[model samples]
Target: MKLLLDFLPLVLFFGAYKMYGIYVGTAVLMAATVAQMAIIYAIDKKLTTMHKATLALILIFGGLTLFLQDERFIKWKPTVLYTAMAVALAVALWVYRKNFLKMMLGSQLALPDPVWNRLTAAWVLYCLFMAAINGYVAAFFSTDAWANFKLWGYVFPLAFIVGQGIYVARHLSDEAPAEKTE
Candidate 1:
């Protein structure tokens, strides 16, 4: 549900771009993200730091794409986003001496410290790899090609992310009983 909600704007952006052109499509996408941010603020009364950063990137990069009338700007958005995430994760573990994923996921997943460290490393590697792929697609392909990659390429990493989650779950403590809601 959360994923679907978060994805709505991107879907809308793609649909609009396909039907119209970059200017209108970018406008629609920007508005959609703003609406989502509004809802988040309304619901939580305080914007999360990550959410704020994401919104800023969307505005700056997305706005530049529209203003400059260049599709490459928007295409580079993912590279920047993924690279920023990877650097943040890597630096958290290496320099800050903290497990970044734990800060993000530990509340829901009761994994051990070692598991958290390994998972954080995996995420860092994943981000770095995806950043490279995003660059390749955007550089070598047409705008449409890169957009399609953005839309379809999501499934690949997400599938792996889920698989990693399941693998992590296997190591859950035997004493930690499962809770099933009716």
Candidate 2:
């Protein structure tokens, strides 16, 4: 459900881009992101961090899109948003001497801080790398190509992240026996 909530706005953006021009598509995406956020709030009775962060970016970029009447601003939206998140994660890791991803995802998976740091670094790097990739596509590729990447390219890394979590869990389990004996 959470994944669907995240994906729907991008889907709508692509659909709107197909059905209309970039301006209309950005408009539709702004509305769709709000609608999705509303639905998520109703389901959870509160906004998740992802929802808040996503909403912030959408509002900022949407306003820029509307105010400037330039689709290029909105086109750069994802790149900026993703880059910001990556920076935040990196800054949090440096300041706290801890991985923020572990704090965020700790309820679901319990692992050592060192392992969390590695995961966090990987996630941060991935986010930054994707930001660069998005920027490249937006600058050089067609809008349709960028939209396809936005929608379809998401699945691969998500699967890889899950696989990484599983690998970390297995490694932790192996260390558990040794720790118990000591």
Give each model's whole-structure lDDT: 0.82, 0.80
Cα RMSD (Å) between model 1 and the true structure?
A: 4.3
In model 2, the runs with Cα more than 4 Å from the true position are: 171-182
TM-score of each: 0.89, 0.85
Name the lDDT value of residue 151 in candidate 1. 79
Model 2 local distance difference test score: 0.80
Query: How many backbone overlaps does candidate 2 show?
Result: 0
Q: Check candidate 2 and list the clashing pairs.
A: none
The per-prediction tally of clashing pairs is 0, 0
lDDT of 2 by residue, 1-182 (tens): 67787788888888888888777888888899899988988888999686798888888888898888876677788788889888888998988676777767765665777788877788788888888988998899887787788778888678867988687767564332222243
Which candidate leads the pack in TM-score? 1
Question: How would you encode candidate 1's per-residue C-alpha lDDT over 1-182 as one tens digit per residue?
Answer: 66886888889988998898766777888899998889878877988767887788889988998888877777787788889998988898999998877876666677788888988888888888888999999999987887778778889788877989798979777554334479
